[model samples]
Target: MPKKIAAGNWKMNGTRASLPDAMAIAATPAGDCAVVLCPPATLLSQMGTEGLALGGQYCHPNASGTHTGDISAPMLADAGATYCITGHSERRADHGESDADVCAQTEAAWSAGLVAILCIGETLAQREAGETLAVLTAQLNGSLPNGATAENTVIAYEPVWAIGTGKVASPDQVAEVHDALRAQVGPEMSLLYGGSVKAGNAAELFALENVNGGLVGGASLKAADFAPIITALAAS
Candidate 1:
């Protein structure tokens, strides 16, 4: 079986005052599931609680140079990050990042000895047009480098329209995409479903055959909410 994980992306949120919440989450009994928290880069080095593996929200494709405010994978690793998210829908949409850009970033994460949580998803328009699977396939093919393996890479499927929108992909919808992802990434690599995953719906989602866990957004900021989700994955 693939390793089950409950990853939280606290994107652009959290401060020194928020460490207590992260600490509280770190203390939760996760059973067999690994709990990861990707706080903002400012909090990455400071948020390393015992049970929670720390991750970075993003990393530049190149190792180092004058990128002017850009961070590199080695920097994230130095900050104690064991993993980094690449190709998140927001990055793709906000920064105009291309599949090639994500591929390079994944490779950069590997070079820094950091696991890359490579994200791939379709917009509402694409999903409505029945291009979800095709979009995911293309993203997977274009964004992953040759050296990717279960150990160094995790895949996350977050429907672009659903992220932070209080909307979620139904069970059959998640299962279909995750099933396709599993076939391509093989059985060992973990596949996560992101986008509006709350405690109320987590267990049902995690129970799916190919969904190893989630790439949680808003729900992750509070331990009260995120802990149950982690417990749920552990039980699943």
Candidate 2:
């Protein structure tokens, strides 16, 4: 299996001043685990210098084009990003991004020599209807490209209701989805759990059999809140 990865998604937050938080995280030792910080586009190049793997929040499927304010995968790579997140629920909900669009973006990330962190999950209504596994299966099949592998891709399962809502999926609930994902994608692919991941719950989450690491949100904004989670993964 690939080494565990603890990735932080700053998501429309951070400025030059906030680079210090990432710098602090980079300064911490992450034994046997890889750490990545995906800040907004403005900080990719600067954050790259902090010695942590750097990533982008999103990338346009096309390599380049006239799409105003859109950054392509190649452009992200050029700007010092080693990874790019796609198919996040926020994008799906806000921009109406479809599964096919995520697949194209994943391909674009691979084409640019960047790892694609593909996000998938079910909404509260879908989960309430006991359709979590079914929803995950469909999203996994539709979003992942044919040539995906451990080296080029990572999967993040972020239950829509839990994200930023202080509601986290129980260990058993997380295990079921992650196990199914492992079965579908094979054991080699790295699978991450996101949504309300914090220091208090990090170790328990990382202890699950199939969970490799995390795709952190609000907690990742500060080194103080994020480092303990990385510490937990390292211990796991």
Candidate 3:
């Protein structure tokens, strides 16, 4: 059976003051689930590792070199980042990153021996045009490096229209995409649904046939918001 992962992408959030919540969540996470917290660069090493695995928001394609403001995979590994988020929508939008870039980053993560959370999604316009699965298929093929494994890669399906928009794909819709993705990735690779995932809707969402867990955004910032969702995933 494929394992469900309740992974939190802190994004550009988190600071010294917010570190305790991460520690707290790890200390008393719900269920026998795998959990990971991706904090910003500054606190990767300083954060305690009681109940969660730490991850990095992004990592440079190269293991090391002179890339200003870029974090290498090995550097993140050394700083205790067990996982990293690569090819997120924000990166694609903000940096104009192409599929090749994501593939290279995935390779870098593998080289550093860190699990990579590979994100793929379709935008609102794409979805409206009935291009959701097609877009996802293209992105999945282009973004992920070849030979990704259960040990080194986890795929996140975050519909761009739903993220932070207060709009979520219905549980059925989520299952369709997730099940297709699961088939695409084989039985071992973990496939997660993400987007405005909240406590109120988490249980229903997770109960879908292929819905595994979540890769939350705003809801992840507060313990109150995330904890219940975590519990819901466990109960599912």
Per-model TM-score versus the true fold: 0.99, 0.98, 0.97
Give lDDT per model, in order.
0.95, 0.93, 0.87
Global lDDT for candidate 3?
Answer: 0.87
Best prediction by lDDT: 1
Pairwise TM-score winner, candidates 2 and 3: 2
Residues 90-179, candidate 3: write the lDDT tens digits.
999999989999999999998998999999999999988999999999999999887898899999999988988999998778988988
Local accuracy of candidate 1 as per-residue lDDT tens digits, 1-236: 88899999999999999999999999999988889999999998899879999999999999999899999999999999999999999999999999999999999999999999999999999999999999999999999999789999999999999999999999999999999999898999999999999999999999999999999999999999999999999899
Tens-digit lDDT string for candidate 2 (121-159):
999999999999999999988999999999999999999
Top-scoring candidate (TM-score):
1
Note each model's CA RMSD in angstroms.
Answer: 0.6, 0.8, 1.0
In model 1, which range of ten residues has the least summed lDDT?
43-52
Error of 3 at 49 (Å): 2.0
Q: For every model in order, what is the number of clashing pairs?
A: 0, 0, 0
